[model samples]
Structures are given as structure tokens and as C-alpha cells.
Target: MTKIGKLYGVGVGPGDPELLTMKAMRILREAHRVVAPVSSDSAEGRAESIVRRAIPDVTIERVLISMSPQPVQGRDSAPTGGTSADQGGGTDGYHSKDSGYERAARAITTWLEAGEDVAFVTLGDPHIYSTFTSIAAAVIRMLPVVEIETVEGIMAFQSLAARTSTTVCDAEESLTLVTAIRDTSALERHLTDGTTAIVVYKGGSRLPEIASLLRDTGRSKGAVAGELIGLAGERVTSLDNDEELPSSYLSTVLIPSRSMTKTVEAGEGPA
Candidate 1:
């Protein structure tokens, strides 16, 4: 039997090339090809953009992953749960990502059969709300013996905490990472009495609604947001500004829930 090439899912961290882990960089340097997932909705590849700095000389392959939660054209509505384009790991529960995951699985298999190590790069940690899980799940189902290694990277929220000088949580205070939801009410449901921190991913172009929701829920002030963190032309500002938020699909919002009493004092995010 021919040996299958191993697959590595590397989280390149929250947009700063410096944050890329050593193990991830080593894998990138050694991999035969790096697969960067790009959104069908946009021309940019956030993961690939960050990894390129580490493996500038390696061959980087672009794969289109459907991140949209809107029912894909011509397909029946997806069953409850994810698509690969989901902000952190996979799409939120609204849309199905079977097609996109299957496509990526096929691509990874092709590269492996060719005896090439493939690095599937992601932003932040590959395990946290990342499309990596969906793709890896599909690939494993198809080729049971293929070896896979996932390298962890810093999450966007963690970076956001540092950039804004905001504390994520203290002691037992709760923290929630929210990706997508159907409506304002549903979004509010996640904010528990104990959740001290809430990070909203894929807050793309939904700033007004999110901000309104936050205000309605009593988290009226001291929220921070960031877009394209650690990248050139990156912007970090307070949510207090009247600026239209979600400047890019890559935007994130960090709101301090009512439970938080102490403050870190730095928040540069779009509002």
C-alpha cells in the first residue's frame, strides 16, 4: 500500500505574522503545499495572507470554501449546523457546509496521494470555531488512515483582549464566543448573568444590530473591537464611535458583560 501524506492544520494566529507558532512555521516550511481557504464572497484569503510570511518560498494553494450561511443556490436548506466559512471554525448553525467540506477533503486527498504534506492554514486557533474541524472531519471519513496534526494559534479574541488592554475574564466569570445567530433575541440568549466577556465573530456589517443589542442588554459602554489585527492598515477603536462597524468581514467585537467589575482599559474596535 502507498503511504498517504500527512495533513497539518496550522492556526497562524490573529493576523500578526509574529504570532505564528514555531511548530506551525516548521510545518509550513516542510509542507509540500499550503492550502489557504478563501471566502467565495471575497477576494481576500486571511489565513493564507498570514501564512505567506512564514512560507514565502513554498507553494501556496488556494481553495474556495463556502462561508455563507444563506442557503447555497439550488440546494435545499441545510440541516441545522455549520459551513466551513463559519467565523472561527465552521459556519454557524444556519447553513450547511457539506459541499464545501467535501471539496476540501477531496483536495487534501489529492495532495496526499501525490505524496505531498499539506498544511491547511487557519486564522487564530484551528480548534476554536474554525473550519478546520469540518474539513478534518470530512477528510477522516474519506481516508481513515491519513495522519493529521493540528497546531494551535492565538484566537482573535485573545488578541483583541491584548490590543484593547481588556481583560477577557476574571476568576470564575464566564466568557462566551458567539459566531452567528438568526436574530437579536437569539443573540441575547447567550449573554448569561455570569458571562463576563462575550466575543462576537463574523460581526461583519452587523455592527448596528449588535451594538443595539448590547445596549438593550445593559452592556452599554466600554466595548472594544478590532479589524485586520496585526496587519497593515489595521484599525482598533472604541465601540463608542459612531463609525459604521464590521468594516470588513474580518471584524470582531469584544463586549464586557454586566458581570465584569474590573477593567483593563484598552479597546480599539469598530463600532
Candidate 2:
């Protein structure tokens, strides 16, 4: 019997190639071939871009996974006009026979069955709002005995916090991470919940609305927004100055908790 190769889902961190972890780099170097998801055959995806910068000589296999969610009959589909990162993770609770995940999984399975370890690279943490989750799940369903592992990577919120010199949260303060691709009702609720710091992702298009909600809830005092952090066109600005916020698909907004806001106001810095 031939030995099946292990599958590794690696996170390449946010845009910066230098942010790639040592373990992730080692796995990419040792893997039979790295698989990177792309919106189309010709387009280079963000994850692949980071990998190429870090390991220029590594072999990469491109997988076409549409950035937009496909409409499923008789089921409520995600709202349109958001990037793949904005679409959230997983198969959205359902999978189709001819779905992108199915095709990607089949292609990967062939390599795994051939005794070749494959590394599927993703941006940020593979478990956090990453397409790798969907692809890995599909592969597991097909090959039940295959070993799957994940490598952690720095999240955008963490990078944005460092760029803006703002502390994400302190002791006893809850942090809520959410995507603003849909409505603002959930975001509004988080704003009003005392001691909760909210990090909103894919909120570039809804900056104005988010700003208004922050103000209405008094969470806009130290709010900050970052776009393309650690990469080209990087911009980090105060949400108080909405005009300065970059309206890009890679935008991330961090609204500090009331306690942290008080700490900054008092010039004590983060505790």
C-alpha cells in the first residue's frame, strides 16, 4: 500500500512577505507543491504574492476559487459586492457537486494519493475567515484518513494595531471581530456593549456608515482604520477623520473599548 501524503494549511500572514513565520516558510520549502487560491487563472492572489516574495523558487499550483459567492437555489446567499475575504469562511453551511471547493479538493487529492505532501497557503490565519478552511474540509470529506495541520499567522487587526500605535485591548476587555460586508446592525450592537473592543474587517465601502455608528455609540473617539497594512499603498488613519480613511477592499477598522479610550485620553497608554 502506498503512503498518503499529509496536508498542511499554512497562513502567510498579512501582505508583508517578512511577516511569514519560520514554521510556515519551512513547510512551504519542504512541501511537494504549494497550492494558492486565485480568483482567476491569470490573476495572482494575495497569498500567492506573499509566498512568491518569500520563496521565489518554490513551485506553486494555482487553484481557481471565485472570490464571490455563487448563488445557491432555494438558499439565502451572501450579499454581493464583497471580496473573498469579505465573504467570510467555509462553504457557507452547504456544498455543491461542481463547487470550486469540490474541484480544488479533487485536484489536491490526486497529489495526496500520489504520496506528495501539499501545502495550501492562505492570507492571515488559515482558521480565521480563510478559504483554506473550506478547501481542507472538502479534502477531508473525500479522503477521511489524510492528516491535516495548520500554521498560525499574524492577523490584520494585530498588524493594524501595531501600525497605529494603538492597543487592541487590555485585561478583562472583550474583543469582537466582525465583517462589515452586510448590514451595520451587528456592528452597532457591539459598539454599545461596554468594555468590548470591535475590529471590523472588509469595511472600506461602509466607512461612512461605520463612522456614523461609532459616533452615535460614542465608540469613535480612538477608532482607527488601516488599508493594505504591511504592503504597498498602506494607510492608517483615525476613524474620527473619515475623509482620510482609504476605501479599499483590504480595509480594517479598530474601535477601542471605552476603557482603553479613557486610558489613552489620560495619556497612560495601554496597561
lDDT of each: 0.72, 0.81
Residue lDDT tens for model 2, 1-271: 7899999999898888999999999999999979998877887778888899999999899988654555567767664335653223343433344657788899999999999999999888999878888888889999999999999989889998887778877788899988776667778777778688999986788887888888777788788898888777888888775465577878889999998888878988766
Error of 1 at 217 (Å): 2.8
TM-score of each: 0.82, 0.92
Per-residue CA lDDT of model 1 for 1-271, tens digit only, reads 6578998989899888889988998989888888888766456577877777765676778787775565655755643223345244374544455647788789898888888888998888888777788788888988888899999998877887788666667667778777643344545777646365788876655667777776666674667778878776677766755765655657678887554422422333322
Worst 10 residues of 2 by lDDT: 85-94
Candidate 1 wrongly placed segments (more than 4 Å)? 40-44, 66-89, 93-98, 192-195, 259-271
Off by over 4 Å in 2: 73-80, 85-97
